[model samples]
Target: MAEKITIFAHVRNICKASIFRICPPCLAALSRILARFHSNTQRQLVLFLNTAHFLTIGVSLALVVAFFLYAVDGRPIKGEDSFASEESEEFLPNVREIVGEIRPGDSLSSSFRSNGVDEEVRESVISAFDGVMNFREMKPNDRYTLTLDNDGTLIKCLYESGPLEVHAIERTPEGSLAAKKLDVALDCRTVKLRGRIESSLFAALAAFKEDAKLVYTFADIFASKIDFNTETRFGDTFELVVEKYYKNNEFVGYGKILVARYNSKEVGPLEGFYFDQGGKSAYFDHRGYELGESFIRSPVPMARVSSGFSYNRRHPVLDIVRPHLGVDLAAPMGTPIMATSDGRVRFAGWKGGYGKQIILDHGGGYQTYYGHLSRFAN
Candidate 1:
């Protein structure tokens, strides 16, 4: 009687185990097979493995069901990728594009709210794109577009303030926002420009009815040869064959300066031609010597020099003669000061007479110092 009771228990356990994996008919068939096993070791081992295999099959089938439910919706899971990425595709179809420019008292959030966009979606776009673009950098008259689908759901956005600052933001089918920077379309033409400096190189470029961009390009070409800020005379002359960029018939900026000629009385006449061989592009002098300035001449190109770098110099404020290692620049208080060279900051903050200063270590014993700064750039 005890052995018969044990057989019934084994049969009941087998039926319960395979219930989910098999139908009721299959369970009954399995139960009839288990009733013949008794306590036979071979039959008992076979039944144990058979049930274990069905259990694995059960787990697999459950996973397949879950996969089918989600596979119908074709999208990467939310955590699978980041919010924004650089994309090459420029346009999307079946959408109505609403274009607008940023107004004086407008924000991205307020603009979206006025357009009836969902608050949750607007916040997601802001959060996703905040790292790519700063709210403070969004100036008045910056252009933006909203591409809505047939259902009036926002599918894409394009925003631009400058030639190189076009941002394309799009929403995926998964309701995730994707962002990318689009390249600007510009017409490049090699043009010749001739100008004479009346006050400074910057002023000369402005007087020529050209963008201030040409000043930097021309300066960069002859940076090592001449200091346009200090050495430039009123009669200094310049001629250049350069590439200028234009978008929609409006001047955007300047590109590569192919040929440059400068005749300054202090530095004499100097010429440089752009040469690109094998993938390296560089400026070459008339004698074919590569030209590049390792050091910038001035810390402030626009500011006038209040005092020169000197030894045994008379201090204006202290009324005492002392060694003044760094030059003094005359600029308005809180004016931005840029680094003359690239380096890691070895020191930043106050240093007594220097006030707020920054010391940059440019690898080798080459260290540059910026003194009396109003604030540090982030």
Candidate 2:
């Protein structure tokens, strides 16, 4: 009876374990039993290796697919290349053939249309001259010629007649475009000015009530050879005749001074004239001899008046009357100061109150002095 009871208990335990599905010890025992079913250990090791190999291959394939996608879609970064060819063919410049006169009141569009120009070419030509020429003001009988390309583009536009010369450019092969140029041709003119001396050069020039421009012209022409303040006597007089330029009744610029006559109260009258010798223009005396004066009177060379001539002005050290003999030409420093006449340097060194002076001995008791010099001329 006890043996029978043990068998029944074993059967009951197995049924309970199966029903609950929780048999840790049984499962462990089953593993051992299954391990025994394999004939060799090598087979178990082979199974382990197969599982690891599949995992590695799957991960590798995923990485390869990611890399492939990146390579196919990614773009490289490049720098700006201004010299590269443009992609748009529409941006290319157009050159066309044009013959006939473009006049005021003429339709640029209709005219080009009559000439069998393409719509694109006509639009391009009109756009090129849009802000430049007034196409609405064009008159009949006006002569003009244009050469265009298949696209009806203009390369050059020219209008001949009147005070200005016009040149218009529409297209270029390179990436550069230029606006048209209007070269002006002004008429020539004559100008004159007169003045009387009173104590100084600029004061006398101001008395003329002439245009400041005219005075500047007069001074520039004569400054190289004449010293207005010292060399000019108290009762001197100056007269000048010159040539100027005008465009459309407007003053453009001044030319050469035709003639100048200066009469000094003490010094003899000096007459100067401009002459073209061997293709070079120069100021010469009435006798046709070159005025070989060493330097121009004013450093500015323009006709502006000098500041003043003061003796007791202000000596940093002395601070008293030093008797400033020559006039003070308030010009930009380093301006050239020329000798009045051809003479030897009597004294070219520092004088007590003169700072730095150059005294020229004209001989026979005549002498001229220049002080506070930046340098000495050779």
Candidate 3:
């Protein structure tokens, strides 16, 4: 019995020494292997692996197994280096962008709602534009764009009201909404146009793609001398230097007529230059003479003369010989009548033969009369 006890004690001491020496390297390697596993189930799987096979496999092979297990679990490993990465993945939300146009009978609320925006976000957007813009003034074909987060929060919005005006609203860094009005700049370039009167002045201008406003301006500049309704003849030519506005190389509209020249058959040639003096702008001839006249030739534009001035004429209805002093102009009923010259109203009421008449008294011997059956201008 004494000999058996000594042999057992020696074997136990040898086993303890072997375990102490092997644990250090094996524990270090196990910690690295376990470092790749995040969940408890994966760590248990690693422990269940066959011991003989684990000893034969290299560290790279063990790492590959750990990666495969981590992928199947689909959970990120938590460590001191993962806080920033986790936060980055957590804060970014899904975003969506949409553009909407105002149609007939469509309001700002309807536009947002139709685009799948939440009701709460729509109301907040309306409140954001409260004092900045009047939704009632929104016109048809006006466009707007919206940017929203996954939670349906409005992050940014842009409203294009016109070619030159833009309204913008966005969430500020302080978590408050801010709105502003932006004006788009335009590039202005001067262009010269020359055309001859073929059928009519408006037709001639239209052939060259000139704006109708430009034609009206040309007639107004030469209204006193040339009667566009009757005096314009074939082959009469005109030239103009005007301003054209553009944005991003796209034409927008016209600005003003700088210089105008008209060669009329009746009135040889006329040239007008625009000048600003003492905050007042006026058209002048080459000799510095004002082109404006004391009175306009015709009060109504494009009206035909029904009867001319005659010393002795027979009345159509009464069939009596009488003297018609003023010329009679025939026009549509309810058509507006303008004063031939700038003068105060002397009389505006009903007369015997004339239904509704307005008589103006120019200071001198010159006096004009307008007779019609319509309402008077205020």
Residue runs of model 3 more than 4 Å from their true location after superposition? 1-86, 93-95, 107-137, 170-180, 277-279, 296-378
TM-score of each: 0.62, 0.38, 0.56
lDDT of 1 at 7: 55
Provide the global lDDT of candidate 3 against the true structure. Answer: 0.77
Residue 40, model 2: Cα distance from true site in angstroms: 99
Which candidate has the top score in TM-score? 1
lDDT of 3 at 11: 32
> lDDT by residue for model 2 over 1-378, one digit each (tens)?
453343334433443533235355764554454344434553454355456556766787899998777656743323332223334545776655567655455576776677676687567666767777766456566555666555544556554333354646545777343447576777988878777776755666667544455555565556656655457666788888878788879765667788988887665777788889799887788788766455556544432344356655565467665665566665556666656666798899998867889898877777888777877765
Q: lDDT tens digits, residues 1-378, model 1?
A: 566555545655655565444566765565556556555853675577567868877898999888877755655445433233112223334667676777788898877677676776577668767778778888888887777776776677788877778988887788888887777888998999888888888887787688765666677767667766689898989899989889898887778889999998998998999989999899999898987656666655556788888999998889999899988889778656656667899999999988988999988889988888888888
How far off is residue 328 in model 1, in Å? 1.7
The residue-by-residue lDDT of candidate 3 on 129-202, one tens digit each, is 99999777899999999998877788999999888768999999998889888778999999999989877888
Q: Positional deviation of 292 in candidate 3, in angstroms?
A: 3.8
Ranking by lDDT: 3, 1, 2
**TM-score-based ranking:** 1, 3, 2
The superposed Cα distance between candidate 2 and the true structure at residue 334, in angstroms, equals 12
lDDT of 2 at 195: 72
Q: Between 2 and 3, whose TM-score is larger?
A: 3
- Determine which window of 10 residues in candidate 1 has minimal summed lDDT: 82-91
When 1 and 2 are scored with lDDT, the better candidate is: 1
RMSD of each: 21.2, 26.1, 11.9
